[model samples]
Target: MKINRCGQAEALTKEMFQKVLGEIKNDSHRLIFALCWYTTERPSAILQLQVSDVYGSARVPLEKMVIAARTRKDKKTREVPIATALRQELKAYSAPSEGYLFPGRAGHLTFSAYDKGLRRVFEKLGLRGFSTYSTRRGSLTTLSRSGAGIRQIQALSGHASLGNLQRYIEVSDSEVAAIAAML
Candidate 1:
């Protein structure tokens, strides 16, 4: 059997995801990381997110954030409900009332900057191939392995078809167990 090297990208377990989240010091960056894991948003779409996307108003309860059609790869808009716990964490963040979530020299953080930062952290932890894209891929794999239906996963990933979504998900050990148990 072929073994993945330290640098090769691998699907993450819940524990591994938590470890990475703890290591990241920046709240905005952490949110970005969490967003990628919690949903299948492309890095660019994440950078484009604004505070208004989440918190509707002090009076109105927070609701789902809409990923505008222009920002999505499929050119389809989706309203994603924010995780309740994540909402609390976001409430504590000190972002502007109106602006990009992670502003850089340009309007939003450059993809290079986000990638380089992630790579630096991955290298420090003596891991490889854990690029920015890995979060979404790992998340989808995780959801699938946990027995989430394919259609549900497809909804979150915004993948055009079942084939594309399946292409990225890895069969988890838990899934193997479940299948074997079925016999």
Candidate 2:
């Protein structure tokens, strides 16, 4: 099974999100997953984020919450903005502007380490096949199904094109059955 398709892509009902958040032992881990769900950014981009990227004068109206990060992917830099939920979580974990958002033991956020942690979390939660990337896919899929247009999703997800964005949204057999029933 595709790692991204491991489980339900629905936005992890508020209760489930809270449950998973509660299971996290540390604030950093909670912030990591919260940021992932809010930004819908890839693990690499998220791990690459630095404190400066989230702050700085360039981040205008910072008090309004929701900051954008310049992500380097596909030979281009795409700006992805955070959501309100993530902003609040970030505020709670606020670190110095020169440090890493999710610092590792070595003092830098590493995608490999983060992925491993996420895997363990999934295992402990008895969820199979789901990977860290599932957060991105889940966020995008949820947004798409909730009446968000392709362009809006592409912008928020930093996808270069609608085609690329569509690939992340997996319409399952259950959805098809529901649609047929409606018809």
Which predicted model would earn the best TM-score?
1
What lDDT does each candidate get? 0.74, 0.67
Off by over 4 Å in 2: 2-16, 56-71, 105-107, 181-183
- The numbered model that scores best in lDDT is 1
CA-only RMSD, every prediction: 3.4, 4.0
- Segments in model 1 whose C-alpha atoms lie over 4 Å from true places: 1-8, 58-61, 172-183
TM-score of 1: 0.85
Clashing pairs in model 2?
A: none
Tens digits of per-residue lDDT, candidate 2, 1-183, equal 445545533335345556677787767667778777777776776666677666656332143222334444665555556566666776677565566666777866777777777767777997666677677777788787788998998877777877878878868799899999997
TM-score of 2: 0.78
